[model samples]
Target: MATSVKNNSLPPSLISNLNQVLLSRQQHTIDHQSTNSSSLPSHSRNVDEPDCSKPLLLITNCEGIDSPGLIFLVQALLSDARFTLHVCAPQSDKSVAGHSLTVQETVAVCLVEMSSATAFEVSGTPVDCVSLALSGALFSWSKPVLVISGINRGSSCGRNMFYSGAVAAAREALICGVPSLCLSFDWKKDVSSESDLKNAADLCLPLISAAVRDIERGKFPESCLLNIEIPSSPLANKGFKLTRQSLWRSPLSWKAVSANRHPAAGQYLSNQQSLGIKLAQLSRDASAAGAARRLNSHRKNVEIESVGIAGKFNGQQTAKKYFRLELLEETEKADDNLDFKAVEDGYVAVTPLSLSSTDQSKIETEVSSWISAALGREQRN
Candidate 1:
């Protein structure tokens, strides 16, 4: 019930119904993604696949499509005649998130020897999965040409891009001196349709193929990641755009009480509808209390549901609420900021990003310096 019932943009009953349906779909998708697949081939395929000796690409993805979409994605990737698939995905649903490492849990990285793909499940972050795949953990055969993350379930755009594990994985790979890309479909709860997913995959395939080719040719950018947000409709109808990151700050604040304080917690509240609405508002944004109090009229009030400290800007702790980080603006005016615009019928938005300069340049220069030093020693020898 974190949705507004009094909102007239959509009818109150319709909004309520859609919200329930959406939440249910989200939960179902997560649950389905968490379980391991039983449809995989028993043994690894030894067919006309690219030589294991040749360089390949490593793929790391979140857990929305553990079985169905994942399988389809793998099949499509294998359609590339030149690249060998080296994947390390989560065993269950991590959803469309980013860079979360499990320290104390016994998350296994199991070898999944399928027909068209060679993959494993890592009990780690998408970043860790890529690290393991690139390292000697999953594939002991060859170094990857690039790391392709996602084909994620939702439109990981605007501020949502920051929270994406798919994007974070790519960033991590770039930080480790690997070329990386993150692909996501324009998935919105009620706004987007099921056909959108199919369209997104189609749009992503050619761009990714070209990108992979560029990487292989050594023409790819150094220490950069591609955040390709696919449109929700047909490719021709839903045009694509190569875009830059939209720096937007959305702050959030809230307090959580003990579970025992309310006996009917966790489940949907049936009685005392106003109380349910109030609680839902609080759940949506921590700043809702202040926002609610300040608003003289309910004409067009927006709440910032919840917040957490994820990233920092200039050493001050920034809040991440609803997947938006509090960003530092160079300009004093915030109203004229035309940062992110939806691409392709304004139905989808693509927010391309790069890793921090320190993260990118440090490792690469260190490696180059080592090589140069070794060459100097060789001349002496």
Candidate 2:
């Protein structure tokens, strides 16, 4: 059996080194920017030549580009100079979007300012962001050394993974033959603060660093991606646990609402208002055309209608319906080795996931052995 480490925090030396690296990187960025401002043309500067010495890392999140979770994770990773960072994330929340794609529609990509990272906000799902980035249309590099999907707002354990856009984004990267990691904090509303997210990022840095290093050296496990769940109290957690995906699922509750009161209705009105006169004119023209067509159809049916029995109704009234679904809270007892249970027990759950079926025993053994070696003495810090 692989030995487990029980430390709650990273070593002081590692922390100090990371801080120094971050400071140096920040200074380098400032110096480079100043030099570029004087010597380089404005348009050409955006198209930076990739630094071949450093491994490229792409980040995305379901909770939009400006979310604190993504920002904190990005900040944590910036402290490591071994990687070059790029971010392409959704412009708005797409938390439950799963592996959906923007089909038959034009998805927008806008360049955004992020701390020392080449970033873009995509007007699409998390999967769309990854797909676009990997397509070589958005970034200069085609394949990154690794793709990190989150430090998502909530846990994506068990069946929740199927609905998590954060996990899906990482899965998309895995599909494209790149190694990936999906991260989430077991967030509890009103109880978990933003600081927990920062702590989670800091806690996961060692595992992320180890994965990247092993991947570059071709020693990382094959045909699998890691789904890591950090506990709510990151700083007061047990050490890492190699886990299996659980069967637990959160039940859904659907509530009905009036059409006008629906959130979609408000968004539609807001969008139409933004379109202003053009949409109004178009609506008026369409209404008039529709009325004309109805009038012609009525004329054709007038004789047949007149022939119907007096006081007989032809149309049936139907109630308008609108509903929203929410995930309901439930509690279940599961094996400690399962991802969800491991997280609940205050262990950082690292579950190896694969798209294709394989021998479960072999996978568990491989992951356990790899994690034991990677973590080792560092976990004792």
Question: Per-residue lDDT for 1-381 in model 2, tens only?
Answer: 999998899999999999999999999999998987879643336545666788888999999999999999999998866677889999999999999999999999888788777888999999999999999887777799999998898879999999999999999999999999999999997899999999999998888888888888887887888999999999999989999999887888988665467776666556656866664565576777786786677556643212112354445422334677988768599998999899999999999888876786787788888899888734664
> lDDT of each model, Cα atoms only?
0.58, 0.85
Q: Ten-residue segment with the worst summed lDDT in candidate 2?
A: 302-311
Candidate 2: where is the Cα deviation over 4 Å?
1-48, 263-318, 377-381
- lDDT of the structure predicted as candidate 2: 0.85
Give TM per candidate.
0.56, 0.76
Candidate 1 on 1-381: residue-level lDDT in tens?
497677548778998999999999999987776543334343343322436655577777876326454555666777645567767887766654567666767667676655556777777777678766666645664457878777676545556566777777788787777777777765555776645555665555665565665567665455556676665554544344345455543333345443334455322223345766886786577576666664544424433221333454443333333322232322223222122344434423433456563554454444334334433443454
Q: Pick the candidate with the highest lDDT.
A: 2
RMSD of each: 25.3, 19.1
List the lowest-lDDT window of 10 residues for candidate 1: 329-338
Q: List the residue pairs that clash in candidate 2.
A: none
